[model samples]
Target: MISVDGLGPTDYERADAARLTRLPQHDLLVMAGARFGDLAPWRHPEYLRAVAGLPEEQALAALFVLGRQVPEGSLPAPLLALLSHAKIVSVGSGLLSADYALVRLEGLTLLAAWRAAGREVGSYAPWVGTDTSTLCRLVAARRTARTALDLGCGTGALAMTAARNGARALAVDINPECLAATTFNAALNGLADRVAVRQADMAALDLGERFDLVISNPPFLPLRRGALGWLAGEGGPDGLDFVWAIVRQLPELLTERGEALVQFASFGDQRGPFCAAQLADELPGLGLSARMLLKPPTPPRWPAFAERDEQGNLAGDLGREYRAYVQSIGATHYHPCVLSLRPGDGGLTIGRYS
Candidate 1:
């Protein structure tokens, strides 16, 4: 749970992100974008300019809270007290300049209290990720399920969204911090009780419960142990390790004619994201039909990915260990994709976003 602030709703500070675009707080929203530039780069410059344009008092408050660099006494008394109560912005060194703040994801403003990527053992990082927006877009557009399951419920985004759309949601995550965030966000978003968080690994899932819909944005990043590794992000040398295991389990966990919507980095022996081909090979075995909703055109080999990402992901140049590992395993490239699964092997719709 996030530390409580005496001056105001710290819960709001922690989890009101998904609600930002819901209300038209344009000025504050713009400032928020500026404050949270690292996560959403496209809007960075404008937000930075907005912050720079702030009056002295307000600017000091922004600086103090955004990063811990400014002394608490530097800010106006009221703002200082409020910002002081929040815990340390314990993100990776590169991101410590900005404190945990709100970020826009599609239409939802989701919270990211710490760095979004990297996996730590004692604590789980806030997982307001790029693929999560994709998962949200696909899941939110579907007809609401009677009972929805968010298997890797990072912040309970999908489960909470599902509840709002008329489903009783069960959010499960192996990480305690993630479950805490999920349950907290559920209450913060007025989804308390409706969307509950469970602590469980997808591998050990044997709940007698079955659901009409199962959604996940599982960790598909293929990283060697050298980097900041999290057990959650490990998808083996092939990276498809978790994806294959999760889909195999889905066949039994679903209600009759039930459905699933999930997103992942799809790879093939031949390199590049072969999301459709991989699913086509497996879904038939489970007597399941699927619709590959959209495939992002730029695979890992593409120019955009060839550049070192701001997060320092292994996209531009896989580190020596990572490169060696993937090569040894004959794993070439991976791409992002969203797939909708159902009980039959018909109506397999696949398309590009455009």
Candidate 2:
């Protein structure tokens, strides 16, 4: 048996490295079926056959089979598991390359398909899909948003929601492909005129204007020493670096009474109250007040191909250690929070705790 510890240097690094290595290169065409949950052979025989033949360690065969069989409407728990190990690759008609990210739409695999056949074919993900719906509901409940900005607007999900709710909107991202996709999604949803898409970074935007509501689902994962694909997920060593940066810049981007909704994970050692409290403490210096609309704890789970460390513990223990570190910094639990902020409200308030 491969003791989990023997496979690891650490969970994040191990998972990150596995993702990098497992990604199919140019010559190899890995077929993705449905979502990662569609793993049953009945749903994807070809993929299952391919998996059966490859060496088990060289390829995580079970995931390849199960991911393709998962149901359409439900979140693919198995696929999410695979993501902890393999970088998702999207394959479909007229496309045969890897994608930076993957989402599913009506049983079809949707991807930010940047490069195809040595050419850049516009990026795309299901903009109006379930994920969009969930995000839209969150923004619509905010009554104070007269003007809204969607930072890192991959496919204009939040921007469309803002427009639908009567807010003048601007959608921003660093990827031109993402900007184009946002435009396409906006037009498809019949909200094109109300939402404007632009290429800009959250930290370096120059809109020359502030908003009553600013929402972002920024990249918040910690990247390994030399790895890069979608920087959206990596949040630096403690996973709060990007969130801290955004919080610091938010006051200047908001109207005096403006509020912003930002989604972030409390990952690694940065898991609890320390992360929230630190934000609370820092916001005052930036001249802002914050209200956390949602904060839900998420316990650590096993990742695909996860291994163990020399300490006879799962490699993911490093993440737990980091979580503990964050707790010591004042964090209390592993909660994902959506914070609403206004200018100069010295302390952070919890609007809803789940």
Could you say which candidate leads in TM-score? 1
lDDT, candidate 1, equals: 0.59
The Cα RMSD in angstroms, rounded to one decimal, for candidate 1 relative to the true structure is 6.5
Each model's total of backbone clashes? 5, 36
TM-score, candidate number 2: 0.58
The predictions' CA RMSDs to the true structure, in order, are 6.5, 14.4
Give one digit per residue, the lDDT tens place, for model 1 in 127-244: 7665676677767776757899998887778887788778999988877667766655665566776887777888678778899989988766665322444647655554566677
Off by over 4 Å in 1: 1-45, 49-65, 68-99, 106-109, 117-124, 224-227, 269-278, 299-318, 325-333, 347-350
Q: Point to the candidate with the largest lDDT.
A: 1
Model 2: worst 10 consecutive residues (lDDT sum): 1-10
